[model samples]
Target: MDVIVIGGGIVGVATAYQLRAAGHRVCVVERHATVAQGATYGHGGIVLPTPLDAWFGPTFLGSRRGIVYRPGLNSSARRFAKQIAPLQAPDAFRAQWQRLRPLVELSRDAIASIEAGFHLEFEQREGVLHVTRDPREWEQAQSALELLGEFEMLHNVLSAAECAEVERSVPADPAFAGGVMFPQERTANCPLFTKLVKQVLDEQGGVQFLFGRAVESIRLENQRAAVELAPAESERKSTREVDVVSCDAIVVAAGAGSKPLLERLGLSLPFHPIRMLSLTSPIAYEECTPHLTVVDSVRRVSMTRMNQRIRVAGAAVLQPEREFAKPLSESLLEAGTALLAQSTHDWIPGAAKISAAHAWEGMRLLSPDGLPVVGNALHPRLFVNVGHGPAGWGLACGSAKVVSDLISGTPPSVPPDTLAALRVERFAS
Candidate 1:
């Protein structure tokens, strides 16, 4: 079978790699000059199976303070409210986790298989410590431990002293409580991983990449999928003609950008583009930087060390229609700096020197129910492997494998019910 995958982010690249490996001719269409230039670029890069709850879970929604809605972004406020409505019901929150846990584990295994088979390296490190400074947040973490145990995930509860012992960079603040450490959880450079996978895919036969070309429209007719490519900007300026590409199957893995194409096909996906910010700075103090991922659950911020760089990411601005705000950069930098201060107070003075060039903002396509919309959509030849949100790095490989298996008419590695939960029709009335 010949397949065309739209988008060149981690999910699309992973799907293309899987499809090509399964003996199918694959072509990836990306608007960017290179792959992984979208949300996959400069991601937080923490790959963990625990804390499988979505952003709208009880831990977030039940808090006295709801989502921090910006003052001027009123257009998306209603949509953001609707997105969080599903989590209002306690049962719905639990169900979302039930749907997410299996995928997380499957992703971990799939990534391991890929690494072992291809001998790929991407500055990955194991272990992640999820800590909290608030007493209420600590109680929430303790409750989450029961769910982690039920999943049989490897984790250990730690006291403040134990956490400091394990991660020497963390400060022994009086407000600090205990945390759960997932020993197997790892962090890696997501863009580097995606690029490496693309390199391997390029070396393998039966895969083609169309870069710097936008997909204008995707339509199905006579049991085949046809994708009309918009003329490249350079070609349009030169008045060069562009051509459409037809294939036996099409996989929409274009992250937030997939929504527009799906809408053109008369399918509405409940994915809202939420902008997130991250700041990366060179390690000023070796002993001050953490060796493992450190997540501040109270602040919803995370800090991790990748080789010589320290990355801090947090804050979800749920505005799909608005452009990037210039003011948010300073606020995000302050938030990231505060996270670093909580972990390594000694390094704060030196880390404060980070400039705007090190700050990055990207948009994640978040589904209302908090689970990715994967599997077959309205058309038989059209499939979607998107809506992974912040978990894209952790879930990309497994989601790609599932979509590939579905396209190849093979049995999926996960259970049938799990696949059903991720089907596009789930949002249909």
Candidate 2:
């Protein structure tokens, strides 16, 4: 089958790679001049291998610290609230986890397969510490601990002193109430991994990347999926001609920019836009720098080590309709940056030169239930793989594989329940 993937971020690239591997002709259309120029570029590199990470599981949407909502009345906000309400119940959460864990494991294996095949290095590092600050914070994590044990994932609950032994930079502050160390989980450079994947795909000879082209519309052409493309917004306005490209199927993986395209086809999804920020700082003191990534559960921040530098990222600011279309607000920017900086200072003080940090902010579209939408939607030939939220890197590979299998009419490697959990129809009223 021939497939046109509408997006060139990590998810789209991964999908294209999967389709190509399955002996399908694949093309990726990206609005930017290059890939990973959107949410992929701004993503935190941490990949949660297990369901215990803050970004995964049912408790994710319930965390006030992770999702900071600006005051406003909007349909999307209401819908988001409605969708997450049921997830707060213990039974509902476990059921969702049953559907989520398989995909998480599949994606982890997919990453390993890709790494082995290409031998690409993307600043990969192993292990991650999910740290809690106080007794209350630690107590709130009991559910996650229970889930980890039930799943039999490799983990160790560490004392504050033991955390220091594992990561020399972390001081034994009294506020530190220890952490759950996922020895098998790791972090990697997300943009670097994406670009490397694209390069590898190009070399393999079955995939094509059409950059600097904006998709103007989607319509049926001769019983097949087709997209009209014009020069991207960044391009010169002199080029007015639109190019029509048709394929057997179309997979929309355009991240926050997907709403308008899908809406044009009469499919309205609850895509709550959340502003996320990431900062990269040079290491100030090598001895003080953390050897692995550290997630501050209270602050909802992730401080990861990528070689000589540290990448600190977090902030899930829910935007109202009025603010969603505009640039990130100044107050929001200051607050998010302050939180990240404070978390970095708290966990590994003086380990990074925060004053000279490079930062990025991107709007991330999160599905109400916190799982990504990935399957056939309204039209038979149209598909979607968006709303992975901040865990895009962690789930991208598996989501791509699932969508590719669906397009090819192949039985998915995962169970029917896993596929059902991510289906776009799951949102249907």
Candidate 3:
């Protein structure tokens, strides 16, 4: 089979890799000069299957800090707020979690397989500690902890002293309370992983990458998918032509960009681009650097160590469309770094000194129901493997395998009901 995957982010690259490995001819068309230049670039890098709670859950909505809505400040703020209202219900949250947990477990297996089979190296580490400074926040986390237990996930509920003992880099702050630690959770460098996989895919053959070329449009013609490409460096001359690539199957894994492309094909995906920020800086003190991922639920911030660098990420601003040039506000960055400081106050000094150049702001593509839309769409040959939200890195490999299996006419590793839950037709009502 000849397959063309649009977008060169982690999800696209992973899908292309899986398709090529399944003995199909694959090509990945990316708007960027290199892969993983989008949301996968500077993510939190934590692969936590146990923490399967969606952002729209009661905890996040109750906190009122996970999402910030500035109606007059943005054109789409009001509509975006309305779109997310349905997901705020307790039943909606539980349903999304039920659909997410299996995918997450499958993702864990996929990651393990990739590492063992390919000997992949991406500074991978194990363990993630989700802590809270406020006692009320800690109490709220009990439901999530109970869910993890129900899933038979390997985790431990720790007191403040226990948390400090487990992660010495965490400060023994008096405000700190008990938290949950998923011992099997892992972290890796997302960009590094994407680049390494792309390298392996190139070496393995049967795959091509069209970098610096944007997918302008996609349509069905002659019972096949036609993909129109615009050169990364376009000219105003009328003589220039739009390049069209025809394929037997097309997988739309373009993250936030997927909605627009699907819209051209007459499919309306309820996707919102939530903007978030992350700051990466070299660890000032080796001993002070956390050996595992540390998540402050109250602050809605996460800090993870990537070799010598520590990445602090949080602050979600929901937007109706993707914003590429919008920079991170100083207040948000300051708050993020301050949270990092509070998380490591007793252990690290001067932790809030990250330079502006090291900060990154990217949009995470989220579905209305808080679950990704995968599998075939309205068009027969057009498939989708996007809307993983902040869990892209964690869920990339599993989603890739599922899409590839569907394309190859083979049985998916996940259950049939799981695939049905992710199908594009679910929104057809």
Candidate 4:
């Protein structure tokens, strides 16, 4: 079968890779000159499961330590607050975890398969330390620890000294009461990994990439899905010419850009865009540089070590649609960047050259239910692989394979219940 994947971020690239591996002809359409230029570019890159409760419960909504909502309360914020109320319960959280765990596990396997096949390294690291500053916070984490044990995830609770010993760079000032360490969990440069996969796909010769082009429209032509593309380069003016690429199927994996493209097809998904910030800086001190990903469980910020650089990422800002349309001032963006810097300094003081950090803000599309929408949409040939939200990297590989399996009429590796949870029809009223 022939497939045209819209977007060239990690999700789109991984989807294309899976489709190509399934013996299908694949083409990835990207608006940027290169892939992973969007949310995949500067993410936390911690390839581990974050506790489900972190997105909700008493701490998430109004807490300055977590996501920040801008310009006052909006519909999206209200909806998220209301929807996650039930998830605070242990039963609800467990169910949600059960639904998501298979995909994460499968994603780990898929990553391993890719690594073994290509021998590619994207500044990968092996473990992640989730830190709690005080004893009360560590005590509050009992339910989460129980859930991890229930799921048989490999982990160990580390003392402050053990955490410092494990990470080497986390300073003693913050004084971690205790922390959970996922020794086998991985971290890697997400954009670098995507580009490497693209390189491998190019070498294999079944996949093609359309750079500097955007999907102008989607239409069904003679029972096949067709997409009209226009040049999306900043320097290029609008052109009358439109290149139509027709294929047996089209997968919309365009991240935050997926919403508009789907709306063109009369499909509305429950994707809300939350602008998140991150800052990457060179390591100022080698001895103080973290050997693994370190996450502030309270602040919900993640600091990852990518060779000589450390990326401090967190702070989700939800705003109105009109606000999203207008250009954001540098000062406002810097405010969010400052939050990351503060978290970095709090955790590992003088560890990074924060003055020279590259700040980034990207819109991450999140579903109210927290599970990604990944399967056939209203149209038979039109499919989707969006709304993995902040867990895009962790779930990308498995979601891609699931969509590919669906398109090819092959049985999915995950069970039917899990597939049902991810399909678009679940959103129907």
Runs of candidate 3 with Cα error greater than 4 angstroms are: 72-92, 234-239, 320-352, 355-357
lDDT pick, better of 1 and 4: 4
The TM-scores, one per candidate, come to: 0.91, 0.95, 0.91, 0.94
Write one digit per residue (lDDT tens) for candidate 1, span 1-429. 989999999999999988987999999999999998989886877864465334656565445232334435456645656667767455665666777777877898888888999999998888888776667767754445666777677889888888878887776656377777888878889999999999998887788999999998987976788899989878898766657899999999999889889999999887777766677777776656677788766555567777777777655664435544344556644654454444334312233224432867777887777789889888899999988977788788889989999999999877877888898888888
**Residue 313 lDDT in candidate 3:** 74
lDDT of each: 0.76, 0.82, 0.76, 0.82
**TM-score (C-alpha, index-matched) for candidate 4:** 0.94
Task: Put down candidate 3 lDDT per residue, 44-94, tens digits, no spaces.
Answer: 787644543356555664575555544555556556566666655555656
Steric overlap count per candidate = 0, 0, 0, 0
* Residue-level lDDT for 381 in candidate 3: 91
Q: Give the Å shift of residue 398 in candidate 2.
A: 0.3
Go through the candidates in order and give the C-alpha RMSD of each one to the true structure. Answer: 2.9, 1.8, 2.7, 2.1
TM-score of 3: 0.91
